[model samples]
Target: MFTTKIIAVILCCLLVSSNGLQPSTCSNQGDGNYGCFDIASQGSCTEVSNQPASRDIRWPHSGIDSNIDWAIKCGDIIAYKIQWFSGGWSGWYVPGVNDMDTKVNNGNGLRRMWSYFYDHTHSYIICKTNDSNKLRGCQ
Candidate 1:
């Protein structure tokens, strides 16, 4: 049983890393109020506002997903496009891994990020969610 559990965990981790899909800083926290998602510089590359890691939580009015809001990296155009296409996530998300598909609810965040790489491959991206929650947005 121990071995099986270990193997299962390893497989899960493998699947998650298969596409370099980094999980959210805070795993599916109900509403950022409890713990807002923070965008990072390593993975899910995002736009920056004033200083590094000092982006405003209120970018626009609010993401279309519920009351969840998205704080784009200051002026990252790709970030804006991704959010525009995916409706902006209050937290980090990946398609074909954590998310069921990459066509619904804007599951292309990871894909777009990964595909946006100069060589069509990115190490990671940064996504920060202030008052966003509800995993229903993805798989």
Candidate 2:
């Protein structure tokens, strides 16, 4: 009888502990910051400069799975990030120039796309005249 009681207690303890343990999640608080459920946080975004700048884009994954699709112009660059329940968050991966257009799983946690400017200047100007001819490929 004592052995059966001890086994029941152990099983109860395991159930309680399992209920308390849950998977971590990252949430985009909308201020360019990804807030984590268990850990501290992922990161944030910064302004864009002509010299070189990057911004961190975040998405939350509670249950549903999704993907993020983006496009870039000029000479900007981009990268991706993902996190799993087994391992920690993955490092930033810079995709090749020809592989710019792609989609990533949203459940992998908040993803980031970085845009860079190789020019030595910290500012840029886009000239758009009223004429259709002036509508260049600046868009």
Candidate 3:
């Protein structure tokens, strides 16, 4: 029974750690900084400045411009800020909000906003960050 309890505890810890239950210790690079990770390599970090300067919006529709290419994937944890044409910013959506508000809210609104941004009707990509520098991406 003792052995089983120990194994259970160990499994729980592993599961929590893998799910980002632990805090991230990665260092911040300040504003206007970008961290790069090789498309082929994993567990490494670098800096890249070649990201797109601005994204075009189609107005009636919401989505990113077809010409623009996103470096990260859908499930990939990344940082982004919400911009409005009226001249306002919504702050960085780290972990895409769903991961952040897992327990508090259902994250339905955040998910919708993200979908709108992805569709390209809103604003452009101002800045972004990833988790290459830390154990996980965009923690």
lDDT of each: 0.34, 0.36, 0.39
**Model 1, 137: alpha-carbon shift in Å?**
37
Better of 1 and 3 by TM-score: 3
The residue-by-residue lDDT of candidate 1 on 26-123, one tens digit each, is 35444433344445333233543322221333322222322222223221132221232343322333432342224433442222322222221122
Q: State which candidate, 1 or 2, has the greater TM-score.
A: 2
Worst 10 residues of 3 by lDDT: 59-68
User: Mind giving the per-residue lDDT tens digits that candidate 3 earns over 68-127?
Assistant: 223332133244444445556655554434323222223332222444353332322333
Where is model 1 poorest over a 10-residue stretch in terms of lDDT?
Answer: 114-123
RMSD each, Å: 20.0, 21.2, 15.0
Best by lDDT: 3
Q: Write the per-residue lDDT of candidate 2 for residues 3-79, one digit (tens) a residue.
A: 99999999999999886343356556676456645422322223333333223222122112112212223222244
> lDDT order of candidates, best first?
3, 2, 1
What C-alpha lDDT, on a 0 to 100 scale, does residue 39 get in candidate 2?
28
Measured by TM-score, how close is model 3 to the native structure? Answer: 0.27
TM-score ranking of the models:
3, 2, 1
Which model is ahead, 1 or 2, in terms of lDDT? 2
Using all chains and alpha carbons, the TM-scores for the candidates as numbered come to 0.16, 0.21, 0.27
